[model samples]
Target: MKQELRKQFGDEFQYEIALNGNEALEVVDELVEAGVNVILILSDWLMPGLKGDEFLILIHAKYPNIRSILITGHVDESAAERVKREAGTYAVFSKPWDSTKLMEAVRICCNKN
Candidate 1:
């Protein structure tokens, strides 16, 4: 997925990867301190430490302007609804997602910011 994103967007955007939710938050803090405008986040539902929805909610609370896209192999309807409501999730994709749709969504989110 990372390779696909880079191939699709090239150097147009700076992409960062984190091993887990905590690391992701740290990266976000560093980027914020560096005056980077973090417009979007793409997260997996399952990861070490905080779950993706939980992490997105936390991020939304701290950085409301940031939009998020969630990729999950498994998530319940209620959880999806909650993230959409509380985290301002821009999109959600299931596992084995269509590359075209994912890229299109990314493009839309990037353009919005």
Candidate 2:
């Protein structure tokens, strides 16, 4: 997935990978220290530790400017609403996402004119 994203985004964007939410937090910290401003996070809902929505909420609390997208195969309506209302996510995509739509969301959320 990272490779695919890297191929799509190329060297224009910095990408970070983590095994779990905790590691993701650490990576975010490292990026901040390294003077890299995070623009977005694309995460799976069934992550190892914290769920995607929960993780995004956590990140939003600290860095409200950062945008988020949740990609999951299973999502309840109420959970989706909660994440949207609470996390301020850019959008939610089902599994086997459409690359064009995903990129469109990214552009809309991160670079709206």
Candidate 3:
């Protein structure tokens, strides 16, 4: 799925493949160390090892400059509200996503001069 998006975007974007939350964090850490500027992050809410909001919290603690969009279907409204309050989530999407809206939101979030 993401591969197709990468193909569509071409050199306008780059991607890192990670098997899980820990791996994703490791990749993020490396990017931060290398001074790579990521304008936005879109992450799934449910993942092995850590929830999406939890992982985003960790990333936010370290890299507050990055914006985050969370996708989830495993939680209720109360849980979503709590996550938004506690985790600084920029936006949330329900599962079975809409690709057009997602891409538009991505562009809005990642816009640079």
Per-model tally of clashing residue pairs? 0, 0, 0
Please list the C-alpha lDDT of all candidates, in the order they appear: 0.91, 0.82, 0.76
Tens digit per residue, CA lDDT, model 2, 1-113: 67776766677777788878888888887888888989988888888989888888998898888888888899667767777889898788988899888888876776832
Listed in order, each prediction's TM-score against the native is 0.95, 0.90, 0.84
* Runs with alpha carbons beyond 4 Å of true place in candidate 3: none
lDDT string, candidate 1, 10-102, tens digits? 888889999999999999989988999998999998999999999999999999998899999995778788999999998889888888998
Specify the poorest-scoring 10-residue window by lDDT in model 1: 104-113
Clashes of 1: 0
Between prediction 1 and prediction 3, the one with superior lDDT is 1
At residue 106, what lDDT does model 3 achieve?
72
Candidate 1 Cα misplacement greater than 4 A, ranges: none
Q: Ten-residue segment with the worst summed lDDT in candidate 2? A: 104-113
lDDT of 3 at 43: 82
User: What global local distance difference test value does model 2 have?
Assistant: 0.82
Which candidate comes out best when scored by TM-score?
1
Evaluate residue 84 in candidate 3 and report its C-alpha lDDT on the 0 to 100 scale. 72
By TM-score: ranked, best first: 1, 2, 3
